[model samples]
Target: MRPRRFGARTGETQLRSEEYRLLRDLISERLGLFFGPELRSSLERRLRERLGVRGLDSFADYYQLLAYGAAGHEEWDEAAELLTTHETYFFREDYQLRAFQQEILPLLAKKERKRMQIWSAGCSTGEEAYTIAMLILDSGLFEPLADWEIRVHGSDLSKRCIAAARRGIYGGASFRATADVARGRWFVPSLVEEGKSGVSASVRSLCHFAQMNLLDDERTNLVGKCDVIFCRNVVLYFDAAARKRVIDMFYERLVPGGVLLLGHAESLLNVSTAFELLHLKEDLVYRKPLASTAKP
Candidate 1:
């Protein structure tokens, strides 16, 4: 179907082809969020909600506000949150978690006189980072009870999500895949809201949260080198170039021999990454090879 035309008055719902291209490209460039032609209707609908909020008549006006307005920088944050999906939960992609717990953590245990860091890049609401903490504790490798500097940093583009993550509270949906034993062990019953739970003190102690854009060089450099990085389903929102950019950033962040775990839907198949495809018994993962290790 053809896109609707820009209307002459208020409450207009139109997003012309020119407007869509400008807005789509601007969003993709600024936020690394890609919406193909097939998603034009959905994109328009989402932008339509923004127009009403900004008191604009058309998506073109909204695009101008986003592209050239004084508040454009701030507006990009809102657009990022709206356009991106944040559907993460504790213990997502069980197979990948299994691979990490069963095979990877033991491998990291071999590293002597070194701190362990794991980054949950694009962590939506902090569940994944906490899960990593819980898994580390379960393995009994890290001496989490001691003063070991094991840090699980969780970063996301959304400031709002970061705030919620810091709060360390989650709703029922975030716990659907979680088992009763884990729930009883790792979470405390919510005082503010029923049916919600706060991440346990032990889990909270090991994790840190930050509001970060994957494309921002300065912020990523601040992450330092990590032993493992769990980026999961976040990268599928980006286009080819954006995907490569993110993959490269992941490589830089990881220490040599560090492993990267992605969602079942994501892979480095077509991307030119330095990461070697590491095969595990339960799953396939990518590992940044050590200086002595050759490409597989």
Candidate 2:
């Protein structure tokens, strides 16, 4: 599709085809993200805010700043933040969490390994990562192994988001799905803001946050191996090719027999065959096969 001819309007600035194509391609290549032609209007509006921040007037100027400016990489970080921040709440997708706590935890606890590492890939604002920790603690499975090491790492592409996650603070909106019992047990009133709360130190101690582009293999490797991966709703914005690449990365990161949980709307139908389908009592999940047990 060709760029739409945009003349200056009263308040809204137009994003030409040239600039949009360049920016879109860069975002896709770097972050495995996509914004189709239909989203041009919305994308333009969102990016216009960035232009205002930089005191620029044209999308082409912003594109040049992102493309060749010495500060381009820095500018891209802000742009990435704007483009990627999504609405998320604590205890989202409860059914899947139930499967994790009641069904999966016992089986995993039975394993010979005393240490458990869970990666909340694309964990936005730390809710999901913190939620997972609460579930694990609530399960009361690690009590037997007093010395067991438990850590939950949350990674996101937005630096702002990672910062927020690290701070462990949340507003009222984040607690919409959270039950009162869980909230009372794990959170305390926030000193920094009114009508908000922060995750308790006990729960915060079990979680870590970092800014990362999931498609970057070098950075991703630093996450080490994990026993279970929760990559919910994050891949829905990716193109098919990007989806496959990220899925492959997840496969490499998970230990044999480790589980990979996707959002309820997401599935591996055409993504990959390497992971075996696992039907849990409450939900369906996927797992990597042990080398000795894998089929030819």
Candidate 3:
């Protein structure tokens, strides 16, 4: 039986057990994500909006519409947008950036190619990706590697978030944590057109934004291999088994000796055996061991 919510005019419009089960099943099948019962209220609120859009009052009706209606494809996108969380900021975790600047960039500079590629997986609004760009540029690494291709790709499941990232406009609330020097160097203050401040063209051009669902194997394959993948604050939403599976996928996507950065709360200890955990003075990172290093 599902728990009931009291003190509501609508009574316990709480998602029924069967509805919860169906939602979990559908989301897992479509996106490899499982939402526990604790997220019932959030799921209910999001689904309620979809139901209202269709003028349907029951979960069963909404499910049927999603399953059999011709517009089911559109509904799938709407559901993804509703459920995908997009909480991120410029240099949200400073320690990881410090390690990249002091450690990773210097190592890459000695490599024959002198090129570096980074992917900001689940990048919410381009802040993290742009933050990486600033770090690389500020470290004085770009000049020597000018001949090498420097690419930063930011991808998320939410099309809306991708659209916003592509626009590169942010409010003061988003910049509160940003350093004053970084703000002056990376962003040019613009007129309060439409009541919002804008960033400079230079910072905006550093990243390419795209809509990608991590669970889609083909979509993940399309991204190709990268040197550094920052998939922070994302896998905690999944179960243990799902987390392991996703971590394995990341391992395959990264080049040998490539780095993987996670959120402060996340770790690769039990989740993956393929990665060699590396502890820097400033941050914790993982590396996909080179073939020779992995061989017995």
Per-residue lDDT value at 240 in model 3: 68
TM-score for each predicted model, relative to the true structure: 0.92, 0.91, 0.90
Q: Can you list the residue pairs that collide in candidate 3?
A: none
Regions more than 4 Å wrong, model 1? 1-11, 292-296
The true-structure Cα RMSD of candidate 1 reads: 4.1
Worst 10 residues of 1 by lDDT: 1-10
List runs of model 2 lying over 4 Å from the truth. 1-12, 292-296
- After superposition on all C-alphas, the RMSD of every candidate to the true structure, in Å, is 4.1, 3.9, 3.8
Clashes of each: 0, 0, 0
Candidate 3, residues 113-140, lDDT tens digits: the string is 7667789988887788888888877888
Error of 3 at 183 (Å): 0.5
Name the TM-score of candidate 1: 0.92
Total clashes in model 1, counting residue pairs 3 or more apart in sequence or in different chains = 0
lDDT of each: 0.84, 0.85, 0.77
Superior candidate under lDDT, 2 versus 3: 2
Whichever of 2 and 3 has more TM-score, that candidate is 2
Candidate 2: tens digits of C-alpha lDDT, residues 175-282? 999999999999999999888899998788789999888889999999999999999988878878888999989998999888999998899988888898999888
